[model samples]
Target: MRLPDKTTKMEQAVAAIPDGAAVMLGGFGVPGTPFLLIQELVRQGKRDLTVIKNDANETGMGVDHLLVAGCVSRLITTHLGLNANAIKQMNDATIAVEFCAQGILAERIRAGGAGLRGILTDIGMDTELGAGKPRVTLDGQAWMVETALRADVALLHAAAADTFGNLRYAATARNFNPLMAMAADTVIVEAEQIVAPGALAPDDIHTPGPFVDHVVHIPELTQEYAVVRR
Candidate 1:
C-alpha cells in the first residue's frame, strides 16, 4: 500500500518539537543538516534542548545557530572542536557536553533503532569516556555497556524525497540521517527536491517513507562547506 504524502511547511515541521526536547540532528557537518528547519526552530525561541549530532558545527552555520540562539542546553556529540562557540559554552557551563566515540555513537543510535537495550564495547574502556559507565566481563574480557541513544524528534536534510517521504541523500549527506530517522519518535526531513512516489528507484532510497513523519520541500538548494575557518 502507498503511504500518504507527508510534505509540510518549515514551521509545521518543527512545531512538534517542544522545549527541553531531545532532538537528533542528522548531519555530518552541514551536509545533512536541516538548516531551514533549524532556522525556524531558532526563530521559535525554543530553549533547553538536548541536541545530538556527530559534531558541533562551525560558528554561524548549521547547528551552530542553535548554539548561538542558546536553544541547546546539552550536546551529545563526538566532538566540539569544530565549533568554537560550543567549546566556549561547554567550558563556561552554559551548556553540558557529552563526548562519545564516533563509532560508539553510531552504534548506540543503530542499537536504539534495532530495539536493543545497548551494546557492550571496549572502545572506551579504562578511559575517561567510560569512567562511570557499568562494565561487564565475558570470557575474561571486560566491556562497557553503552546504552542505546534515542530522540524525541530527528531533524534531517535530504537531497531528494518523494511525496510519500522516501528519501535520497547526496554523497556524505547520508551519514547520520537514516539512523536518526529510525531512532526518533518523530522524523522531519527538509528535502531539496520533492517528487512523486516511485520517482526514486527502490534501490536509491536511503530512508523509507514509513520511518519519515514529515517532509519540508526547499525551493532553493543551499550548500555550506563543512570546513571551519579559524
Candidate 2:
C-alpha cells in the first residue's frame, strides 16, 4: 500500500493513543514539546501511560501536565530535577521512575532506531543506575548494557513540516525529536508551519516523511515564546 497523507487534527492524533501504551515525548523542556498534543492527551484523561523522555519538565508545564493528570504510571528519563512534582510522585511511590545517564539514554534510543539489541557503555557501571542490570566485558573493559528504547507512540514538535510529514526543528528544540521519530511505532508531529512537499530543502529536513505517521499544524512562537501567528 502507498504511504498515507499524514496531516491530522490534534484531537484525533492524541485520541489514537491508548491507555498503558509506552510513549516517547520529544523535548528537552518546553522548547520542542508537543504542547497541544500533550494538552489533548491530558484532556482525554489517558491513563497508565509509560512516558519515555529526556527530562520531566518543570512543575505545571510539559511532562508535569501528564503527571498532574495522574495519567503517567512510569517515567524513563535522564533528569527530573527541575520538576518537583516528579520527585514528589517518585517519593510517594505513585509513579515509577527509571534514571538513565544522559548519554546512555540517547544512545539507547539511537540503538533502537538502528535495530540494535542495545548499547554497551561504562558510564554508569558500578553506580546505582547500573545496579542489578546485566553486564558484559568487551575487549576486557566492563560495560553496562542499556537496552534499546522503543515506544508505541512518539509525540514530537517541529519548527516546520511538509504536508508529506517531513520535519525540521529549530535549534535546541531539535534534541530528541529526530531520534524518537525513528524509534517509535507511530510518530505524530506538531508543527509551527506546514508547507507543501518540496517546500523544505533536502538539507534542511531533519526527519523524513517516512518516519512520521501524522502531523498537526500549530502557530509559530516568537523569541519571547508568545504565539506570533495563529
Candidate 3:
C-alpha cells in the first residue's frame, strides 16, 4: 500500500500510536523536530509515552510541550540542559531518564534497525553512565554493552519529502531523524514541503521511502523561541 501524504494531518499519522507506546523523536535540539505533531499528541492527551530523542526541546519548542503536558513517562536522551521543566521533572522523579552519549544513541538506533542484538563501546566506562548498565568482554577488553533501541513509532522532521516517502533534510537538521526512521516500526515524517516522486536527487535522500510510513506537512507555523543556533 502507498504511504500517506504530509497534508494528512498529525491525527491521521499518529492514530496508531497508543498511550503507552515507545517512541523515538528526531531532532538534536528544536530545529529538527516535528513540533506540530508533538503538539497534537499533547492535545490528544496521549500519556505514558516513552520517548527517545537527542535532547528535550529548548525553552519554548520541541518536546517541551509533551513534557509540560505530562504526556511522556520516560525519556532517553543525550542532554536536558535546555529544558528546565524536564530537569525539574527528572529531579522530582516525575519522569524516568536514561542518559546516553549522542553518538552512542544514534549508533544504537542504527544497530537496532540493522537487526543487531547490541553494541560494545567503551565510551561510558568508569563513569555514571556505566554504573549499572550491562557490560561485555570483547577480546579480553570490557566494554559497556548497550542494547539496540527500537520504537513502536518514530516522529521525524524533514526539510522536504516526496509522496513516495523519500526525505531530504537541511544541513545540521539531519540529526537523529534518519536513524529513528530505520529503528521504528512506524515512521511519521513532518515536512515543510512535499514534492512529487523523484523530485529529490537519489544521492541527496536522507531517509528512503521504505522506511517512512506516513508524512505530515506543517509549513512553518508560528515562530516559537525554542530553538537556539549553535
Candidate 4:
C-alpha cells in the first residue's frame, strides 16, 4: 500500500478548529511553539478555546496571542509567571486558569494518549491544586485522582518532517510535541521543512506519520523563531 502525503495548508488545518474547542499547544516558551499555527488561529478568530500547554508564553507570542484576542475561555497550564497578559486575564476573571504540577501535567496527558482513565498521586494533596479533586487511598496514603487530558486539536512545531508527516523536533523544542501529538483527536504540525518520505530515517522520527493528521511546511522562519533566550 502506498503511504498518502499529509502535507496541507496552514490556514485549512487551523480553520478546521471550531469555536469552544479544547486545544493542546506544544512548546516550551518560543522553541517549539507553532507560531504560524497560532497566528492563523488568531487570524481566523477562533473563540472560547481551552488551551492546554506547559506555560502561558510571554506576551506577544504563542498562547498570549489567543489570550489577547479573547479567544481563550480557560487555560490549563503549569504557570503564568512569564505572561503578564495571561495573569491579568486570569485575575480579572476574563479567563479561567487551571494550574497543574509540571510532572503531573505530563503524566495526565500521557495517560490520555495511552487510553487510561486517570492517574493518582500525592504531589498536590495538600495544596490548592488538589482542592475538590477526587481522592483515593492506596495502601496507607491518600492520592488525588487527576483525570487524563485529551484535546480536540494539537498544534506542534517540528524541526523537520516528511511528506508522510513523520516529524522530528530539535533539542528542547521536543518538550511537548511528541506527547501532544498522540493525545489529540487531530494533530497538525508546522514543519520548518518538509521533505520526501525517506528523507527522515525511522530512528530519528519523534512523531510517527500515522499519528499526525496534517503537516504544514513553513517557507521561512520569522522573527518569532529567533532565540529569545539561551
Estimate TM-scores for all models.
0.95, 0.93, 0.93, 0.97
Clashing residue pairs in all predictions, respectively, total 0, 0, 1, 0
Model 3 is weakest, by summed lDDT over 10 consecutive residues, at 221-230
By lDDT rank, best first, the candidates go 4, 1, 2, 3
Candidate-wise lDDT, in order: 0.89, 0.88, 0.86, 0.92
lDDT of 1: 0.89
What are the per-residue Cα lDDT tens digits for candidate 1 across 2-118? 669889888877877999999999888778888888888999998999999999878788789999989999999997787899999999999999999998999999999889989
lDDT tens readout by residue for model 3, 1-230: 55555346678778778999999998876667877778888888899999999999776687898998889999999999988999999999999999998899999999999899788899968989888888888899898888899999999889899987899988888989889999999889988889987688889898898898887877776465244556
User: Candidate 3, residue 40: CA error in Å?
Assistant: 1.0
Off by over 4 Å in 4: none
Give one digit per residue, the lDDT tens place, for model 4 in 1-230: 76899999998888899999999999988889998899999999999999999999888888988999999999999988999999999899999999999999899998998899899998988989899999898899888899999999999999999999899999899998899998999999999999998899989888899989999999999888897863
Error in Å for residue 191 of model 2:
0.2
Candidate 3 Cα lDDT to native: 0.86
How well does candidate 3 match the true structure in TM-score terms? 0.93
Runs in model 1 with CA error above 4 Å?
A: 223-230
Superior by TM-score: candidate 1 or candidate 3: 1
